[model samples]
Target: MNVVTRSAGIFLLAMAAIALPGCRPASQPSGQIITLRLSGWQSNPNEKQRLDYLLRKFEKTHPTIQVKYETINSEYMDVIKTRLIGDVAPDVFYLDGFEAPLLMQYQVLEPLDRYITPEFNLADFEPSLLNAFRYRNQLYGLPKDFSTLALIYNKQALAAAGITHPPKTWAAFTVAARKLTVDRNGDGKIDQYGFGIAPELARQTFMIKAFGGQLVDQNGFATFAAPNSLRGLELIVNQYRRDRTAAQPTDVGATWGSEMLGQGKAAMVIEGPWSIPYFKETFPALEFGTAEVPAINGKPGTMAYTVAYVMNRKTRHKEAAWKLIAYLTGKEGMKAWADQGLALPARRSVLGELGYDKNTLYAPFVAGARYATIWQAGKHLPTIRMNFNNQFISALLGEQPLSDAMQRAQDTANREISWAN
Candidate 1:
């Protein structure tokens, strides 16, 4: 018997043996407790507190089941993979879309399709995100939350620039960015940049795909060096290296785009829902607004990221583990998690109930999900991402032309993929 069933049998036998004087068959009122282990990476203090509150509520509602939560903040993927190989992984754990393909291919994750019921409403999930964790028609994980990139701009800076509204297209966005670039002290040095950016491939792939550019061919070989693919990326390179209007976080001595904007070093940024909490807590006095990512060639595009709660196939408590996963990803629990606006709800009903679609601050992000490119490829994506980022940064810094930089990146990435295969 499995761990959950074995534990249940032991409880029943103990109850029969210890039928004491005048004691009912069910020993204690609530009966024996079974514990399930869950592991995930640590985010912020607020996120942790809310999760704990929700978990405590779950425990209260289901008195017969208890949960054991563990956090591994540093090198999360490495730690999780190690535990999986060691056969000591938790019953349930956090999994990102980027890493799901590799684990699913190995068949180490439990197939969740059997556990889902009609009332669970699998159709409630966003289709693209839901499809990301499916392998060979078998559902393996349920997306707990998702975020799509949107235009985040400082309102005071826009007013200072004499702009009335956010840009609606690529041409307009570029023009506004230039106007937003300012030298407040007139000291021949920039006091604030127009845009703050990150040069990583994770953020740039959507740009590559925006104008019909392909990241990989049918065989999963790197193909982003093609002229058509480079077309969209050239705009970013021009803004950063030629116009000198945009600054990376490192250039402004801040850790990320959100920080640069909060510190008044950058007037605008493209970011996700997680930035909402940071902005409110870090710079309560700063005025900002969210808008849909600017359209490119009259077509809108952005990137979407999702995280799911997956079950370990080696788990001894399959039945109990499924219950925990079901509750967390269900309507009630997801609403409790997304109500604070830290992450958008993955379930459609919960989103509609929370009224985020009507909220001006979050509508942009929710709307972007329809057109955003998910940041996932084949199993070789992790390898391809590293090579692309290295050369992509070189191009942004004017070390070489965009075409040449992409060529070097594509060639190197393909070679690595061949070696791994």
Candidate 2:
């Protein structure tokens, strides 16, 4: 069998092992039922439904353990921090890649290296994704789901514009976008835009990387003011002003790329796997396809957002908590989650079994995995995001030049980094 097929076979074997009766370790059960609290931000109705099912299955398999689910609706990080300080934190919680560094620095999370078993096959996860949760070579969390950016386009819109396929280069992309934009009613107002670009830290960060700009220096100092970085920033702003074919999410009060594309207000967007299920459910009538993100000056690029399951350092039930985490992130649970097509799996083996390799809508996302840039994790991410968001929004409003805005953002981010140090 080929490498992918072989990996899939191994993953199936692992799942079988997890599903077998009496798969728990030989250590004696405490004989007392334990209740574990798990918490995370709710994404959508589908995610909640899947999680409820998984939790119920876990409860059935381990009769001695009861799981309680809680969600913080406002300011997730702040609420989680407050609860941790109050000594009432959940036993397990979702940790975003950008926030992991801050939490790890505060010594709030328990390192999970001790709980890793040979059967867990940590090597199965992408090394880059796994590195996000590591502190001094000690693993702290296991990735649950990951997302990578891809070009999502409306097939009908492309056909109407006389374009045979999505653009492959930035030059062609601009041309196609201009062609697709229309003032359909002769009201001198553009009714359809070719693209929807969100003006936010995450999107800008990805752009900077696409143009070969690093957000931080070797010592983790902010470096977004570099010339190439400014060039990258100008590329998107120019597309908005010069071409008039792109609209920001704020232009339509749409919070995300999927919504704008779903409404047919935008013909194309750069989004992640999460939008797949959202589109399938929210706008079932719309026909769309995805391609790898267009090359920037001949170099392919995209962004990745990942989250992991982490344990509380002060939890009284470390052993039981680890068991639950292992099972949830193991081959069985990971396969089940990925199979639902809600999000891409972090493991290579699971992706094959789910047929993501041959799936045209999902193949670009998978192909971009190796080249996609992961969001930076550090003690200053929160501050950096705040500074970038403010300046980027100003640039988007045409109040400042892209160069000036990026320089100011870099300076402000550096000051925050200095203060933290």
- Clash counts per candidate, in order, are 0, 0
* Candidate 2, 1-421: lDDT as tens digits: 3343343344334333332222233354667788899998877766777777888888888888888988766789767776775667899999889888767655678889988888889999988889989988888889998888899999999999999999998889889889888899999888789999977778667678766787887777777878877767777788788778999877867887789999888999998878888899899999999999889878988888889999888777888788788877887888876776767888888888788979998999999889878886476666677778889878877899877887898887776566545
Candidate 1, residues 1-421, lDDT tens digits: the string is: 3343343344334434432332111222347787888988767777777778888988998888789898889979777876776667888999999888877777778889999999999999999989989999999999999999999999999999998999989898899989998888999798799989888888888888778899989898999999878988988888888888899999979999999999999999999988888999999999999999999877899999999999988776777788899999999999998898878899989999999899898999999989889888876787788888999999888888889999998988787666555
Candidate 1, lDDT over the whole model? 0.86
Candidate achieving the largest TM-score: 1
TM-score between model 1 and native: 0.91
Task: Quote each prediction's TM-score.
Answer: 0.91, 0.90
- lDDT against the true structure, each candidate: 0.86, 0.81
